[model samples]
Target: MAWAGGQVNNPTQADAMKSRLQAIEQDLSKNWEKRDELNRTAERASTELKEIQERGIGLARSLYRYSAKADSLQTRLQQMQERERSKSAAMARRQGQLAATLSALQRMARMPAATLVAIPQPPQNTIRSAILLRATVPKLKDEATRLADELRTLKALRANIAGDSKSLAKTMADLEKERLSLSFLTAKKMRLLEKTRSAEHSAATRTARLSARAGNMRELLWALLKQKQSPELRGEDFEPPPAAGKPETATAEPPTPPRQTAALAPFRLPRGPIPALGRIVTAFGAKMPNGTLSKGVYISTRPSAPVVAPTKGRVMFAGVFRGYGNLVILELPNKDHVLISGMAKISAEIGDEVLAGEPLGEMAPSTSSLPKLYFELRRQGRPINPLPPKAARRNKVRG
Candidate 1:
């Protein structure tokens, strides 16, 4: 009886162990599925974000064009209105001259022949008066014709001014619609970015703390880079690139790396482009009013002009820094950094991975005197020119 019980108990222990192994296998399978589903979601989100950003940029460019058109139309309308006013004044003067000429002619026509002969004693004086009357009649007729032409011109000018005013109104309306659309797109983009950043709340909070404690731009950027290197701050989503030339393991597939990490990888050369669409008011290395050499080029943009990223990179610090106003610092590949300042509003947040031509922010509204944007590039903590070589050469020639 003891031998039989021992054998039965051993079989029961084996069955229990088998059941536990099956449960563990099921849990592992479920976790893998969940991870894959999350990856798909992330990919979809990224794709959607990219599409939104591209559309937003296109809309921004359209808005800029419309703004320029509206400004031109407004200027033309003002000039036309001024011309109309001047013509109207000239027409009034012509009417007065014509009225005086007509009154003189009427008085002469009403004068009796006997009265004229009685008033004039000398026949030669009478003949001269008659000659003068003849000449005045023709002159009055010519003046009346000239006045009629001036009135016609004034009417045409007024019509043109009215037409231009209508055009300006239409252009302004179009501009407002485009602006509203862009605002909507911007809000949508923010929502998507926030969703992706939800998991990195702790990292973002730490970055904010670091930014607050930072003394200057350099210190803040240094702290951010250091923090990004830490494993804890990188979060669980961070995936280091696989070892170079390592053999692939068949047991399981490696996780896909995060987009930000891929963007942070070193590149051959950093791209140098103006981050905004505008004219360069202050060139790099130019003498400033304070008698100091300017480190970055200042671009004078239209009111509420769209500002874009100069290149693909990750945002390290984005907020008001020092006296630079709303500023954004992007960490580029190959240890390069780009700083943009003078934005009235910053659309990007810290740790955002931005693509080239992506909307960064916007310049101040037309309320400001002149909206100027500053672009500065740095490599390994030293300031460098942000303009491309060709552009720099062209600027030099212009200078």
Candidate 2:
């Protein structure tokens, strides 16, 4: 009877164990599905971020091109003003010459021909006077012809100036529209970035704080790496509470590239368009008004000039830092980096691969009439004078 009871208990135990195994398998499958869904959501967010970034860049480029057009129009208007001044002076001189010539003709007409010629001292003198009068008639005719031509030219110049003024006004209006569009796009991009960063922060299972206070970029990077590598607890143990407004579905995303060293390795020299569209206002190492030496050159440009990439590389950082408004740093193929700051807006994003001469951003508006950009080049974390010896010869401010 005891042996029979033992066999019955063994069968019951086996069935119970099978039921527990099935339940465990179901839980494992659900966890895997949840993980996959989270990964897909991250990918979609990344895609959205990239799309917004690219759209912002396109708008910025358009704004820059329009600003350039306005500058060119203004320059042409100035030239027209100068030409008008010169022509006005020439017209005045022609008018005076014409008045004198007409007066001489009228005097000759008032006096009888015989009286005019007879009073001259000798027969030859009278003949000479008559000959001179005949010659004066032709000269007067030529002068009148030249004066008419001058008047026409003056009239044309005035008309051109008026036309140019109108055209410039229209161009400026268009530029204003572009500026507004770019502003809107930039704001949108910033919002998107903020949203993405927030989402990433929330989604991360473990986080590291490098210091009690907010840290610099280097420290932020280190903390981010540490957070990524930290072991995450089981969902039932220490899982993050379900976020409010959780997305329903997620798409898969490519794995993010591993972070590289902060310092770029030096490669080839920059051989593309210079970073800024302006004249060098201050050279590298120049004394500043604040009594400090400048690490970068200051380029003064027309408002909102397009700042382009000087070489092919990936963007390292693209955002404001401290007082360096809208700063962008590009890591070159060989590890050199170029820093462009003083931008009104940034178009690129971190890890974006930018081509040489691609538009990166636009100059910010200045308190003065023209905006200024601060540009620098560094190799292996050390800044060098970016302006080459031949830069002076090659430098040109674009309209």
Candidate 3:
């Protein structure tokens, strides 16, 4: 009876252990599923962010073109209006002159031929007045012809001004439309950034602390990289492979390469096109106001001009730095760095993988002065000219 009882207890304990193992397996399966779902969500968000950025950039370009057209039309309208005012003033003066000449001619015509003899005036004086009147008739005729021509020109100028006003109105409407579209895209991007950053709040907090403590950008970057390598900030944990005898139960699909590779692969040098639509006001190595050689280029951009990434890179820093307003630093795949500064707003966040031409930020809107963007490319911690070879040579020659 004792042996039978022990056997019964043993079976019950074995059954309990088996049930617990099954529960553990189920939990592991759910966790894997959750991870996979999160990955899918992240990928979708990344793709959506890219699309929104591309569309926003296109709209921004359209806005710039339309704004330029509107400016041109406004300038032309002002010139035409000025001409109209000048023509109107000239016409008014001509009318006064013509009226005076006509009145004198009428008085001369009304005077009877007998009156000239009856007035007891000298014959020489009367003959001289008659000769002057005869000469003035041709002059008056020429003046009338010239006034008519000016009136015609004034009419044409008014018509052109009206046309330009209409064109300007149309261009402004298109610009407004593009601005609205860009605003929508920008909002979407912000929302996506918020979502992406939410998951890494702890890491971001740690990075922020590091940034605060670091003395400069170089120190900050080094600290960030070091923190990223730590387990707590890695945000990923992988289970060791099953022991040799066990069969593999799950396989992860290899990650697809980033979309920016194709666009970035062709460039041998880190320098791509200028990151924004603007004129380069200060070239690399130029003398700055402080009498120091400029380490980067300064671009005089239009108000609220869209700023894009110059090349494919991962964001290392995206925030304000000492003396630099709204700065961003990108780490290229080849271990190079690019720094962009002086933006009014930064759209990219730290650790974001950005593509070439991806919208990164915008210049501040300013009516008083054109905003300037600063761009620098660094190779192994040394500043290099970001201009193309030909452009660099041209700048050198100019200098």
Candidate 4:
């Protein structure tokens, strides 16, 4: 519509607005066409990678929420663990006190006393009298120990669940960003289509160019979506050189402690019957369920089977571990720390000295059927692949 007198009509502004609207439509159309191509390409990628990509995307969406929940759960578990530990300490103190008191009382009883007051005995043939003093004392101690152990295990499982949850949560932010980008790309695609339909191109040449641009935009969008769905992509274009003054180098890790040569520690030997176990289900080099490789060997065994210490050392740590389940850390003189996981029982107490072949612990009977002895050889805190030699590699000749 033409403007009347005195109304300075700006047709150029109208044209510009029309042009922008046309561009938006064109971009959206292009995205729509290319998204299908991307999906096909993603389907062709390695199933493992595809799975990881899907997981990563899904994780990105839920990570933040999970992290908070995990952290809270972990806090609760930690509090419970502290309580359990306190309870255990108290129990141990009581056991020590009882042993000392009983020993003292027995020694006094043995010595002739100047004054003797006969305490009233139970009625003859009473069932309570049948309880043997020796059996009763040991049973009471065993019950206390079992209670402490159960609490420890529960704490460990809680921590592990929290750890897994935190890892899951960390991925949430990334997924959300991707989702938004996807939405933007989608909207852009729709706009492109709208542009293609509404553009008032008269000449055949102009129409062809607009169509080509629309096609390119579509391809770009499709490529982006594909990139998200598949981890593999051409890096040459995306790889940027280090910016000026920002040096980049490989990050270094902490060094492990050397082996100590002190005298060996001593502790109690296992009385339970030991049984043979089976092959390792997962190994140090074995690929984890995720893309990353594992850091230790998971020896499959019956749950009740004894977890023997491969070498003599002191029980440095004994507690529940996440992912690893019940764990015992043995500190060898060689500075090699052997971590035993998935135990039904931890016979060797934490800080207790123990000899080689000593039973560290055993798994539960139910667990024995699906038993896994996750062993890790670590130097200090750094993980060392246990599949290879604790001894130096030697060359061998072939026939």
Against the true structure, what is each candidate's TM-score?
Answer: 0.71, 0.63, 0.71, 0.29
Model 2: worst 10 consecutive residues (lDDT sum)? 249-258
lDDT of each: 0.71, 0.62, 0.71, 0.47
Model 1 lDDT, residue 220, Cα:
66
131-233: candidate 3 lDDT, tens digit per residue: 9988999999999999999989988888888888888889878877776777678878888878877645566566666656665555565666666567364
Between candidates 3 and 4, the lDDT winner: 3
User: How do these models rank on lDDT, best leading?
Assistant: 3, 1, 2, 4
Off by over 4 Å in 2: 1-38, 113-131, 199-271, 284-295, 306-330, 344-362, 385-392, 397-399
> lDDT: which is higher, 2 or 4?
2
* Tens-place lDDT digits, model 4, residues 244-356: 35322111221321222122221112111111133456645556777655666665553344455555676645555445556676667765566677776665554444544
Task: Kindly report which residue stretches of model 4 are placed more than 4 angstroms away from their true locations once superposed.
Answer: 1-276, 388-399
* Least accurate 10 contiguous residues by lDDT in model 1: 248-257
- The superposed Cα distance between candidate 2 and the true structure at residue 375, in angstroms, equals 0.5
lDDT of 2 by residue, 289-319 (tens): 9876666677887776667666668765666
